[model samples]
Target: MLIYSILFPILAIIAIIVFFFRFRSGKLSLSSFFIWSIIWIFVIIFSIFPDSSMVFARVFGITRGLDFIIITAVVLLFYLGVKLYYKLDKLEDDVNKIVKEVAISNEISLDDEEEK
Candidate 1:
């Protein structure tokens, strides 16, 4: 009957399809799959019952449901961004450590061959 009524289900279905494809293709990790599934389920629930957001906003002293959603989304995105950055940095450090070890080992073996 309404735009959201039509849009929400479409978006939810698309997200589910993407999730399945990514998971099956090994592009998405198990933890990420569960996290995204929960996020999509919440999106569907909020889209279907927007009035709940209003109640939530009132409780939090926010003026509108849309504003509450926007603020929450922004904060969540920022947090996830910081988390991913740290994870990538740690991975890079690990790779560098492994590479350094391999290089040192090869250098030692080369020296031994020269000594022989």
Candidate 2:
């Protein structure tokens, strides 16, 4: 067993525990928790059985396991990046809407005719 085989699983386990607590505390959404869990679980699997990637690579028609892993990582990253970008845009819009509503509700009257 390589050093990484033991080390990566340990780190992955720690991350899973930390995220589980965060999810329980309502800091993470169900989907977010599950996504992170899946990612970490894959890390643990791959670290423990490095040869398993070759099977996955064969399925994907990739000649090398490392290439397959890299491609998958890039694709996953792009997907996640797009997801986060959309969420950020939605949050920005929500904040702007709330601010506008608050401003309108708390409007100040400075008209001279109205003050008279």
Candidate 3:
């Protein structure tokens, strides 16, 4: 429990730093980072309580802290999976747009060469 309390916050801090850097570089969306940070904070807060496992077990019908952790982790992983899927979709759209622009430029260049 003590180790979890310490490690959870440290991990959250690291995640925040990474997200901030990515956002600043315009590689990440602010909304996604903000939502992820909020979830991290919740996990950190829950980790601080020794009885958190018990609470989670009672409230969620889980058997143990490890189980609760697994459930939460799985849920978070799924959420991130969905988020990444959307981001990939956006990237694909951006790539298609750039490709179309390049094709148009090439066509115009070909027309100019023909005229000359």
Candidate 4:
């Protein structure tokens, strides 16, 4: 009950903020709300379940729910880190391509000037 009381309001606030931002940007979509609602529902259900932590630990083969939560969080963070790294790599490649094109054009212009 305590967990639900703390988490439900936080999730609700997050959903509201996300919806507000999307609406303000004129890109509001149903899918985002749907996902958020699903997550909130799952969290609420999990919070209500007695021995939820023990269930999670048994399912995950972890000693405790806290350990399972820590492991899940670490995995999520690593995944995000890898995703951001790839995005940055792609951006760097794009910038390098543009720089190379500009350099080539500048060199050609210099040659033309020298010829004249």
Worst 10 residues of 2 by lDDT: 105-114
Alpha carbon lDDT of residue 28, candidate 1? 95
lDDT of 4 by residue, 62-104 (tens): 9877676568668867987997999999999999999999999
- Model 2, residue 55: distance off in Å is 0.8
Q: Deviation in angstroms for 94 in model 1?
A: 0.5
| Candidate 1 TM-score over all chains jointly | 0.77
lDDT order, best first, reads: 2, 1, 3, 4
Superposed by TM-score, candidate 4 places the C-alpha of residue 82 at a distance from the truth, in angstroms, of 1.1
Report the poorest 10 consecutive residues by lDDT, candidate 4.
Answer: 41-50
TM for every model, in the order presented, reads 0.77, 0.85, 0.68, 0.63
Cα lDDT tens digits for candidate 3, 1-116:
47888998889889888988998899989897898788777777777875676776778888787788788889989988998999999999999999999999999999999999
- Between candidates 3 and 4, the one scoring higher on TM-score is 3
Q: What are the lDDT scores of the predictions, listed in order? A: 0.89, 0.92, 0.85, 0.74
Sort by TM-score, top down from the best: 2, 1, 3, 4
What's model 4's overall lDDT? 0.74
Model 3 TM-score, 2 decimals: 0.68
TM-score-best of 2 and 4: 2
Clashing pairs in 2: none
